[model samples]
Target: MNSESSAQIDVTKPHPARRYDYWLGGSVNYEADRASADAVAEAFPTIHLAALENRSFLRRVVTYLAAEAGISQFLDIGAGLPTAGNVHEIAQDITPAARIVYVDNDPIVLAHARTLLDSSAQGATAYLDADVRDPERILTHPNLLATLDLSKPVALMLVAIVHFLTDDDHPHDLVRRLCDALPPGSYLVMSHGTDDYLDIEDRAETSAANQRSGVPFQLRSTAEFSRFFTGFDLVAPGITSVTTWRPEGWRPHPRKEAVSMLGGVGRIGTRAVG
Candidate 1:
């Protein structure tokens, strides 16, 4: 990590990426992150399971894109800590020449980006330290341009990241801007936290806990989450809980309510909404 970026990292405050890393049983988090994660876990005991389920969804989606959809390029935003089954790892495994660009605002992610940059000799990887709110910056980054060709089909990955953006953030516009930059035949892959499956009381409790945890979280309903795919055509098994989204061969899949995350893939058609 460069001294400037290292100086920007405040271990005293809890960040969403670090807290998620904590829940995923990664050792790259600090006490603040662990505390925030534990607070949410107190409200939703299955959060750790949700994290694992979301990770599995990412892998399956990437496999479908690379192996089936013939997508050789990927732009994964809100990329958290590097772990097993990274985008480059999964895509390059299927298409040896697959190229990936990972974007994240977290300084900690930047620090560990070296791990993300280790691509298969036939493939390539690049990481950009940028926020999701600034779609233009991510879209125009020189590294991204060099790694992915916007004219070709690319997978725009927004997994488990948009929930951090509140209504005030205009998350829809942000997503649209990114999608608009990709041409027809591109794909949008996303997984988001939702309270749709939760009972009234549990929903209130979970919302309260997330509020008190000091991390910005906005859990949407199924309809609200589905609106994000307005311009594209959803793939089969549209907008279901992450655990149930093509959980191929995984035995005893957990109940959808247990995971509480909605995931889907959408193919950008020629007439896709702007």
Candidate 2:
């Protein structure tokens, strides 16, 4: 990136994506992000495990999308700093013809997304610098258009990103707008953090810390989070914690509920399109 663009980044403040990278043991974060992430870990010692389980959920969902659902294209919005088992990796690993379009607005994330652009000989990859609040922009972006065919089913991946948006952001509408543009057979694969499982005080403290960090975090209830799939058909083991979402015998963390994030994969209703 040019110096002018780089100057816009304040390394002194933590970014949600970078902080997540820190928790996932990625080397792309700065001191500010690490410090904030450490504080979150101290307050909720299971956060790192939550991050791991969240990524694991992404892997399992992507595999199902590619191998079972026969989805060959993915629109992974708010794709944080790349790590192992990324959407494209898991998708293309199953169907080498899979194509992926990753969207994010973080400078560091944009810089690192180049790695996400690498794909198998039979597939393709693309990156777009866009924000989650404006799903229209992503849906219309030239890169996304070039990489994915909206006329066909796409696995829209929103893993662990919606929590960053507050109620005022109308995240539900934003998500709906994105899904509305997809064909009827498309799927929505998402996970969101919640305060439902935490003590009131613990939830308050975590919310306060995140607020002070200049990053908004909203922990919703399971019912509220499930609203994201209102018009779709949920996969089996629907709307459960990421740890228990089709466990597939992969339990990488203890006290799974401490992760406190719910995930589900929902296929857009094919009957609705006619």
User: Per-model C-alpha lDDT, please?
Assistant: 0.90, 0.84
Query: Which run of 10 residues does model 2 get worst, by summed lDDT?
Result: 1-10
Residue-pair clashes per candidate: 0, 0
Each prediction's TM-score against the native? 0.97, 0.93
lDDT of 1 at 235: 88
Residue-level lDDT of model 2, residues 217-254, one tens digit each, is 88899999988998789999998888787777644545
Model 1, residue pairs in steric clash: none
lDDT of 1 by residue, 1-274 (tens): 1112433789998999888898888999999898888889988999999999999999999998998899999999999999888998999988999999999888999889998998888888998889999998899888898888898999999999999999999999999888988999999999999998899999988998998788999999999998889978998888899988888884789998889999999999996665
Off by over 4 Å in 1: 1-7
